[model samples]
Target chain A: MATLTLENVTKRFADGDDEIVAVDDVSIEIDDGEFLVLVGPSGCGKSTTLRMVAGLETISEGAIAIDDEIINDVPAQRRDIAMVFQSYALYPHMTVRENMRFGLEESTDLDTETMDGSVERTAELLEIEELLDRKPGELSGGQQQRVALGRAIVRDPSVFLMDEPLSNLDAKLRAGMRMELQRLQNDLDVTTVYVTHDQTEAMTMGDRIAILDGGKLQQVATPLECYHRPRNLFVAGFIGEPSMNFFDATLEGDELVLEGTELSYPLSAPIREELEGETELVLGVRPEDVKILDEATDDHAFPVTVDVVEPMGNENNLLATFEGSELSINAIVDGMRHVQADERYAARLPESAIHLFDRSSGRALHNRRIDDEEKLLETRV
Target chain B: MTAAERTESGSSEGRLATTLETIDSQRAALYAVLLGLIAFYLSPLWGGLTTAFKTQTGFVQTTPLAPPTPEWFTLEPWELAFATMQGGLVNSLLFVVPATILSALLGSLAAYGLTKLSWRGQIGILVLFLAGVFLPYQSVLVPLRQFWSAVDLAGLLAFAPFLAERADLIELTVTHTAYGIPICTILFRSYYKTLDDEMIEAAKIDGASAFGIYKRIILPLSMPMFAVTLIYQFTQVWNDLLFALVLVTSRSNYVVTQSLNELQGSMAQEYNIQMAGAFIAALPTILIYVVFGRQFAKGITGAS
Candidate 1:
């Protein structure tokens, strides 16, 4: 087991005469046995960060420590890290048994008998015992993925670096593998840094997710922390599916004058205390938090016309336009709710579910408070 | 429905139509070209075989196309061809086999460096080897001969035990191997370049050093290319008459090509014996083509 720490690690690529900063100064301390995911959009340097950890790419600045030893100058082979590439990168020419045995043969001095036993055991763990004699080319994508994982797991490296390992599988298989991967990581309890652009994978799989944007580290937090208490607008918009809705608003006393007074939302005293000095602000709310009220009886509620209703199996995402404003906000409700297009409904922005951000800096002034027990229960399932 | 039943019922009619259309479209042209190619390639072999079996009187009287009659069919030319070319055949084998193997080993090593290793001035080294491929062999023949003579003392000193008084064979082998390196390196390097770099990187991460990767990964992967280059180089060196003629002074040192040439005497040209000798000289190459033809084509086409 190892605690991998990136102390302000940076990577730069010299393209022609200009130096492109692929990964700017990024720091994160991954605890021993923690499965930390490096999550971002494309070209966000998450893969570069993981590659630097694996010693595949050199760190331009700062240091990387495994426990306490700085391995900035160590080559990939000496790093004792086994990586599963997005393509699965299994040796196409080798049988499944041979592919699993290759790392032990090269990196360790185990005898053939012991090595074969380890390989057989790994194959059994992966439930690929029948596939031991088959080549990678003969296997399906899911099977190939299992073999790639087996190849790395058999090595029992200090840490595991996985680069979008399940992105190639179909949705059904990807979902299945995602859970299996989480289970395996828990069983092995090896520090793993998984890189992926898929937020669902990051949200569901990581014990803690490190979000990167434009080669800069945005936030490092638990999945529920990132979901409910985002530090900035980017994190709020990135973590949730259908994303958080944002509206230009002004903080006038205890109420938010949204979109030039088209809608004025009353803020709670506690939320107002947190946003005391902010004037020009952005109000953020998740799709599920935008409640469709029975009738407009209060100042915070406004009648909005539902433009389109998308029926996802468990929830219906209603894309509705606010009254006297062109702004369209999404509200996810119960799937069985008979919401329709061109229907006027009173939408209420609950103060408890409100997130306020600074207009200029995009920094969140106040985030909605989430109960710890509820979050823990949600994560358990 | 069962998958086999669905497949059998769904596409068979369409496939039959497509096959019929294809055959109907190219039928006349395909047969015509096939016939032309067969005649073009087989005529010389037929003429040689019939002439070799023919009596001397039949060769003078009958047309070259005449099939050998039972009375006319004789094995005298075959006996003469075998007896005469035996020494040259042995010498050709001695030269070609070692030369091919040495060149392939050296070329594979060079190819591994050119394709897999990272070093400063790698492109410069590659360009140097590439330049050897296009260099005119005829232009350097005299210089190469002179160079060999200049290096003769060292060659004799180093390989006296190995060469055992046949220092000219050493020169020929060295010269052939040197010339063979460039083309073989070009072929092998291009072939190796097509392999995934991830394989090497993964091997390294698996704790394989550069030489370890080459020995375990590259050498096994390169068997087909080695077979192709070996067969190609063997044929070229075996068929080389000019080098053997220019380098070897004695009749005993003559290779197969020179021996085939010597079948036609100055006073009386024995066409039967000459044809028989040429056919015999070509047998090894024919055997190689029959055995490794598919792999040779696969390697070249895959590289190009």
Candidate 2:
């Protein structure tokens, strides 16, 4: 219902004489009815950003606005934002109905009949109508989770801020709730800012994911776009499972040769032209893109010894070290393929599938090709 | 070696006996010891009850521990004690009720504010309240008496002129309530500290103000602590002999303890009347224990 914007928002905490900058200057604009996920590792300021948005923590600098109205000075109660905590902080003394009715009773002057009606409707929506009389202490964990969700939805707030709300549930329940929550958000059309450290949740739940690290925003893009064409080396390495493999190489003419190793990857015309004057660079490739072949048919393929193999039911992940080098790269192949350890295999890090980044800056200079490598490059040029 | 060896071997033999004994025998021995201790502690109460039933002549003829025969038994001591102590009992009730409820209420609010609400220097204030618990009441008696004397509420409290007439009882109530708060706050603060922080945050986001949260969430959660503090303050104020002695000047202002003191005969000891008065004075405290103990256990489960 509302578009949330953070303009250069920062949070600093006074720790004795030293100041700990919990959230540095970061700006993000989420469209109306959009689901934006803040994702990062532990202590990456993702939760801090969500708390600032929730008005639980104050913004040290810059402003946060809703629908073009700056609300930096608005208290949490007046903000009209409902939040689901990771712990599902339901009042133990109150029954499910009272818990759901609390926000409506406090924030709005709704009559008892109307409040109870809304609570019952929400309980029916969550399929928790039978639990109306039971206190939170009597409910099971998943039940408590639904009650927490019901508590927020009963208020019908414009924006929903969830702080890792699904993390406490077991894996199977978490997956079910994840899909259910996304569907509910789509149906309700509420602007939601969800904070989570789980990459899979970020990738699947959000329309666009904002990746943060060390109190700074790294990238904010669609999950597929972040996976396919990451703006920086951090995003390229962070987005995918078994992540991207990187080799420190120097650009020598058309070839990117691994420093102090004989392993060299010859670039194609377009990439070579792109790297014409560049010297220090890192060649990055995704694990799934590292192809395993029976024979070294081309110059791009190398005879590598498989160090280890991990069978993952549908695919096999092989850690292979290049020939005449100590470099080990993870190569994921089909489960039907028979790969073994301590055996030499022809593995290819194809030129078109490789991404190049500036060695020192950790910025992505060139991304891998899509269906049309030349055409994608043409648009960029 | 003989003394040392005797003790060492005896202890070793006992340890062997303990380990070799079956669980049932050990339980029987524990029950025997506990029953013996119970009897040892309850003998004085038995003596007092028996003495209270004795006639005036039975005091001279029989031992203090002996029960009077049915023909000699009489309820005259109990009747006499009740008649003399009724005014004092009413005076005690006037102060004890307000003091007990006010101290517990104020302390719970203080506890919630100190533990749940964030502010600078809270720990320092908590430590100071903790220090108040250890302060000796004897050291403050002179100052407390002088403070009450200096306080004049003649026209200022015209709304409650009865408070001036019953100023002695009112003074006791105020003194007991103030003195009772620090320990009560310490007790309730520890209980409040165990509450989850997210519970408060959730309440805040639920649009409840700080005072509203305390009313709805904290006050209900602290029912068990209130029961504990109320019973404790009730007993302390009711049994207090020193404060009543210093504060009560007229015979009409006498508390139960002072009235019991007056029951001690001027020339001759009235054991029957004294024991009956003591038993009468103890009933309220015992009744409070019975009522609040059940409430205390049911308010919140101590474990979870």
Candidate 3:
């Protein structure tokens, strides 16, 4: 196992006379035996970053090292890294046995008996023993995926690189593979870097997730840490489903007067201290954190009319607009909640659950508090 | 009212009949055109066959299309043509086989390099190779002859095994192989370009070197292209008269095409012998097409 490090790496492509930077100065150190996911939207330099580490794309700047050795100049063949492509890229011309045996044949000096043994073992691991004699064209998609994984697994390389390997599978199969993949990674204990645009995969699969945007690294932390304590506006918006709602507000001592809205939210003492000198800031809160209060017994609660209700089986995501305001924010409540459109409901924005960011800089000044910091710390370790 | 409805149905049926009649006439016109096309293409072969079997006197006396009489029908033309072009046919085989195979091999290797390898100015190099295809063979005759003389290896032919006595055959083979390459390269390059790039990348990650991938992966997968290019190059080299006429000095060392040309000129009065010799010279190419025609079509269509 090896720790893969990318120190300020960049990738540039020459398009005619213009130079397009595919990946900007981004750095992340994936620890030994840890699954680090590089997650982003399409064309966000996530795949480019993964390719750079795989030695498929050349680094325009900085260094990529594995266990203290710089591998920037090393060719792909000499890098001793195994990768599973998004398409699976199984050799259609070769049977499963031959496909799995290819890497060992090319990369290792093992005898025929040993290579055969490894191929058989890998086939058994993937439960594809019956498929060994079948060509890739003859197999189903999930079967082909197993063969692709087996091809990489048979080699037993130091680092495993997967570029959206599960994206091609159907949703149900993808979920099953996701769990199996994590189990496989744990059992193998090989340092892995998985690239995907699916936030679900990034959150559940990675030991730590590195979110990228516009060719730059936005945040690299544990999934929960990125969700709960995002460093900036982008991370706060990107990490959560239904996204975090933002409202422009001005800080006046204790009262946070929202701009263009008839609402003045009272801040707690600690939050007031954190936003004391900041005059203009944006208040952000997660959909789950936006509580639907039964009664407006406190000043922090505001009566809002629900514009739309999306029943998601376990939770009802209510799109509500504040009283005398055009701002519509999402609030996810219990699925059994009898909420309807055009109904006025008291929505509470808890002071401890609100995040405040600098309006001009998009940098977070204060993040939501953890109810149990000790439990958070324990989960992080 | 019932009569009016019946009349309307009858009028509609009449219109349907008219449409059917029109379709029948259209089909007849198409068949007529097809028959005309068949006659246009097949008449020459028919005439050649008739001429080949007729006696020289009968060939001169009758129109080329006339059937040969029992007394005039003979194997003499066939025997003479075979006897005259025996050396030429042997030499053509010697030259065409190796030249075609080598040209295809070289083209595939070059195509693999051009498509799969990452190097600067690859497009420029590919354009250069493609440009060679548009160059007419007639335009390069003089320069090619000069270059050929300078690099002629006929003196070293004695060191080689078979075909040693036929020295100029070496020069002929080299010339045909070189000329065959541009089109072969184009064919194989476009075919290789359609291959999944991930396969090559995966091979590299698997620690297969460039040559290893070409041999173990590319070569096996390109059997159709091999057949296509081989047959194409074989026909081109086998039917070449210009290079053979210019390069080979001896009458005994002439390729089959050159022999057929010579037959046409020397036996101007002997039309039957000449036609027979021409047919014989084209037989190998015909056999090649007949054998690998499906593969050739598949290769050109880029199905495999």
| Ordered list by lDDT, greatest first | 3, 2, 1
- DockQ of each model vs. true complex: 0.45, 0.72, 0.64
Per-model i-RMS: 1.4, 0.7, 0.8
Candidate 3 lDDT over B1-304, as tens digits, reads 2344346445655555566676786665555555556655766787789899999888988767666889889879889999889988998998899999989999999999999999999989899889988989898889888887886566666677455667778888888888888898999998999999888888889999999999988998898899899899999899888888778887778889877776765526688999899889989999999898988888878886
What's the TM-score of chain A alone for every prediction? 0.96, 0.95, 0.96
Instruction: Order the candidates by TM-score, highest first.
Output: 3, 2, 1
Worst 10 residues of 3 chain B by lDDT: B1-10
User: Candidate 1, B263: how far from true, in Å?
Assistant: 2.5
Better model by DockQ: candidate 1 vs candidate 2: 2
The lDDT per prediction is: 0.85, 0.87, 0.88
Candidate 2 C-alpha lDDT tens digits along A34-104: 89999989999999998888788989999999999999999888898999999999999899999999999
Candidate 1, A293: how far from true, in Å? 3.7
The model with the greater lDDT, 1 or 2, is: 2
Report clash pairs, candidate 1: none
Q: Count the backbone clashes (under 3 Å) in each candidate.
A: 0, 0, 0
Clashing pairs in 2: none
lDDT of 1 by residue, B13-48 (tens): 455556667567466445545555665577667778
